[model samples]
Target: MRIYLVTPRNPESFWTYDRILPSLGKRCIFPNLSMPTVAGMTPRDHEIVLCDENVEEIDFDVEADIIGVTGYIVHKPRMLEIIAEFRRRGRFVVVGGPYASLCPEDLRGTCNVLFVDEAEETWPQFLADFARGAPQAEYRPAEKPDLTTSPTPRFDLLKVDQYHAMTIQFARGCPFNCEFCDIIVVYGRRPRVKGVPQVMAEIEECHRLGATQVFLVDDNFIGNKKLAKELLRTIATWSEAHGHPMYFNTEVSLNVAQDDELLELLRAARFTTIFIGIESPRKASLQETKKTQNMRGNLVDNVRKIQSYGIQVQAGMIVGFDADDESIFEEQLRFIQDARIPVSMTGMLQAMPKTPLHERMAKEGRLIAESVGDQFVFSNILPKAMSRIELYKGYRKLIAELYEFRNFRTRTLEFILNRGRQVGEGLAIRREELRLAARVLRDTVLSTSPRRAWFTLSLLGATLMKRPAAIADALAFAIVHKALYEYMQSLDHHLERVIGEIEAATETMTAAAVNA
Candidate 1:
């Protein structure tokens, strides 16, 4: 039987890196690890093929007995359309991934089969039952499978060159219970990690397949701190033995700052960047969200400490908490600028399905809409201290000011100045790096945005003069700035439409109430 595992096209957003892909000569930021991972779970006898719609179009006409569809909440509409098209043609469709796991109700009655949460067990079971012609309509695993027993993702099936990086997961679930986070709900709070040999083999496989940069795609890389440190040590040794063929990036909680040895190990393991959830700068907001990990010490200092280990700290920031008022926007702007985080992914607070935030918002009758998974677009939860319109306007202004050239330039330079010592002589420069440098130089020189070009050049200069080792990272940051700036410009128009819809809904509800 022929099987097609498909990842729906990602909507254009900051994470998509749509604006910078052309210059970088990549189709998408990276392949969805879930698609390849699900492929690995399929029986080897089946003719399995992986298609990430971001890199290639899905051919509905392809001869396949079963089609598996997966995506985040943002890709819900596309996933539904894909399933509908395939089902209309009489092909069996199976749906799963974050969206399916978090909100199975949304996908019920749509797909022929739905597998919710951790396909490690249920996927193979379904395939076996299907072969015997007695497959079930849904497979919801009651237990999260052991990561050590999980099969290596089918990275060989991916068009590795089409993506900016290859991805692997060393662990599942985060230890923290951030109220707004859906990871804990789906994967649970107890972090399950893969064995060292398994993780190393996967990295070796990615390296063998010519992946220069590997994103460790763990929700929180240090969730299991002891195992994480052990894994990092082995990775460091392996990288040294292999001439450090690939660098890594992953997300971690802010408490990673407290572990000096862990930071060193990460550097030794060739981790160039680690995204942290510095969700909000306000202490009250942090306490409200149960992100006590971040409130342990000075937030800015923690960010700096991680950066000092030569790992660039990218951040996930949120706004529109109940504790936030109109003044929160400027506060966010000032915090980001002061923190000197070049690429702060600032978005409005989202009440994701199955999360504590969602439950609280629903009980309080404040949930205005289902989460679209793109927080930058809008929030689903209504704010308590201000009108929804005020929240929208403030969010728009915050994003705009945060990405302004002057502020971005200041942060980039400050980061360059304060970042910690280099780990090893950086990885051997490749031809692609040379080509990307040339493209950046040419494009910036001929660019319409003089301020942006100057920002790029100034950063390039700073890295070269102070931290020559970080020259590649400097170029990457410049590209990120361009992507964020252009995306935010488009986002402004989208937000206006959302604002109109909210107003119309409010007016209709108010009118109905008056009639009643």
Candidate 2:
């Protein structure tokens, strides 16, 4: 049977960086790593082809016996559109991924079956049943599969030149039970990790494909400390032998600061960047969300300690928690600036389906809608401590202040002042990386001449003089900062109008009710 895999297009998310894609000449950061991976699990006899809609237009006219599609909550509408179109054409549609696994109701009748959960076992079973002419309407696995048995992802299916970084996964699940996160809910909190050889094989595959940067897209890279350290040791040895071509990065909890050996292992592994979820500075909010790991001790000191080890920390922050008050906006801004995090992706907290936060909001009758995955959009639940308007207003103020050109530059300067670690050896500046940094520098120069040009020039000179090898990454980080700033600016402008509309509509309803 002909099998065609489809990844839905990413919407205008705060992190989408659609505006900056042209600057880098890339279609997307990377094609959804899941589609190509699930494609690998399909039986070898069937003709398998995959298309990431972010890269190319989907050809609805293309003939296929079965069409496979994947998406998260944000891509629900697009996935439904694809399923409808394919079903109209008399082709069976199979839907899976995070969205389908957590919220199958979103596409109940649009497809023949909603394939929920991991595809490793389900895909082969579905193919066999299809071959026998008795396919089920849903494929839900009772247990997660062993990562060691997973196939090498079909990276060849991707257009390698179009992405900034190739994505790979070495592990699944997070050990922590943060109430707001769906990771532990979807995959258990035990943190199932791939064997060292399996991870090395995947990285080798990435190297073979000419990928210079690899993102180990684990929710928590250090979730399973023992295995993670073992993997890191293997990566360190293999990367050195391979001339350390691929600069790796991933997400891990803030408690990574507590482990000196793990930090050294990560540094030795040449992990250039890591995203830490410092959700909120409010201790009450952290406690409320059960993110005790972030509140273990002094948060700022933890961030500084991690940075001292040389891994660039990209913090994931959120506002609008039930325990948050008006003070939260300024507190978040102050913490971000103080922490010297060059890239802090702060957004309104949304109650995701199947997460504890969602269930709590539902129980309290505060859930207004399911989170559509829009970071800039309104929260899906009613704020317990503040009005929705107040939350939106404060959120707008927080991001606008934090991401402004002057504020962002000030934070970068602070990073330079306290910058302790140097880039790991053998991670050479590739032509592609340099070109992106150059383009970003040019853009910054064009927009920055009127103010702070001299300061930036001097800073760049110092950074280069002090850490020339790290300059490329520093500039690349500037590119991301620029994207986030631009996104925040646009989000502020649009959200203001949306807030006004919401208030006006509310006023109209109030007036109508009083008249009645």
Candidate 3:
């Protein structure tokens, strides 16, 4: 069968350097990991063509016996549109991925077959069943397959030139079950890791394919600390033998600070950055969400210790929580500043489908009377203590304050100053640092709005002339913040549409009631 595997285009968000990524010369961030994995799952004899719209355009007229698309919550609308288009052309459409697996009802009658959970254990069976003209309404894994059996992703199907970095998964699942997180629900609590040899082999393949940076897209890369350390040690040796061609990045728990040996291994392997989920600093909120990792010690100090090894930390922060009151916004912003975290992914708490929080909200009658599709565009569910409007307003205020060109620049400079000093750096090291610094300044200046040009100019002058050390620390901060600013702006537009729809629906309901 001629199969067309696709990663749908996200109409609401597009890769634009002018919006969020000023420092990156590349057009897009990363290829969609799931579609490629699904392609790998297909039988070898079947002819398959993969198209990731992030890297290339989709040819709607392409002939195929089957059309497969995968995505997460944010890309639901686009995924549905692709399925609808294929169905309109009278083609068999298979929908799967985190979103579809969690909310099968979203594609109820549109998709011919829905594959839930990991496809590694069930996709081959699905292929055989489909080829025999016995397609089932739903396909589910009887058990999560062992990681050792999973094959390397079909990276050759990707447009290597379009993405900033390549991705590889070393582990599946996370140990922590934070109330707002869907990782445990999807992948389970007991972490499953790929063998050390298997992981290195994948890294070697990425190197062969010209990937300079590899993102370990695991929910928690170090969920299995012993395995992670072993892998990093092996990767360090590989880097030594291969002339250090690629740098690594991944997400991990805050407890990474407790292990000096692990940090050293990561540094030796050229692990440049790590994303830590420091959800919130408020101990009450942390306990409420079951994220005890942040409550162990000084969260800011733990991050600073990681940064001391020259591994940059990108922290994730969420604003809405049951325990949080209106003051949470200021608290979160202050926490970001106090921690001196360069890049922060701040979003309002969203209760994704099939999660513990989602079920609890539904049970409490707190879930807004809206469809799953509506939840993706905006924060549909409200917190127990706060009104929907308050949450919306707080989120907007925090985003505007953080992304304000002047405030961002000033905070970045302060973070740099806080990073004491680096002694005994060679000319080569200094030159590379200077280049990164220059790129950050240029990106920040170009990406900000015209109204903030004055602040940008002032920052550029201070960074280049007055504070050389500050430039080094602020570079990564500016790159991520610029991207986030553009993303928030897009969200603002989306929120407006959602609000308009709500108002229209409310007015219609009121009129109908009056007439009755």
Please say which candidate is ahead in TM-score: 2 or 3: 2
lDDT of 2 at 320: 88
- The residue pairs found clashing in candidate 3 are 20-483
Q: lDDT for model 2, on a 0 to 1 scale?
A: 0.83
Q: Where does candidate 3 have its weakest 10-residue lDDT segment?
A: 420-429
Model 3 C-alpha lDDT per residue in residues 1-516, reported as the tens digit of each score: 888998876543423343543365555677778877887777778888998886678888899988898988777778878888888888888988888777778777888999888999778888888889998989888887799888888888777766778999999999888987888988999899999998888888888888878999999998999999999999989987876777799999999998999888888888878999898888998998889978988987888888777677788888778888889988888878767675677776777777887888888887774334333246657676776656766776776777766667766665565543332211134444466556766656665566544555665567767666445444555566556667767777766666666667768988999999
Stretches off by above 4 angstroms in model 2 are: 423-428, 446-459, 465-469, 512-516
State residue 312's C-alpha deviation in candidate 1, in Å: 1.0
Measured with C-alpha atoms, the lDDT of residue 392 in candidate 3 is: 69
lDDT of 2 by residue, 223-301 (tens): 8899999999989898778777778899999999999999988888889689999999999999999999888889899
For model 1, how does the per-residue alpha-carbon lDDT over 157-258 read when each residue is reduced to its tens digit? 999989999989999998889999999998899999999999988899988888888998899999999999999999999988887777799999899999
Question: Alpha carbon lDDT of residue 513, candidate 1?
Answer: 100
Query: Could you say which candidate leads in lDDT?
Result: 1
| Model 1 Cα shift for residue 308 (angstroms) | 0.8
Name the TM-score of candidate 2: 0.95
Full-model lDDT for every candidate: 0.88, 0.83, 0.76
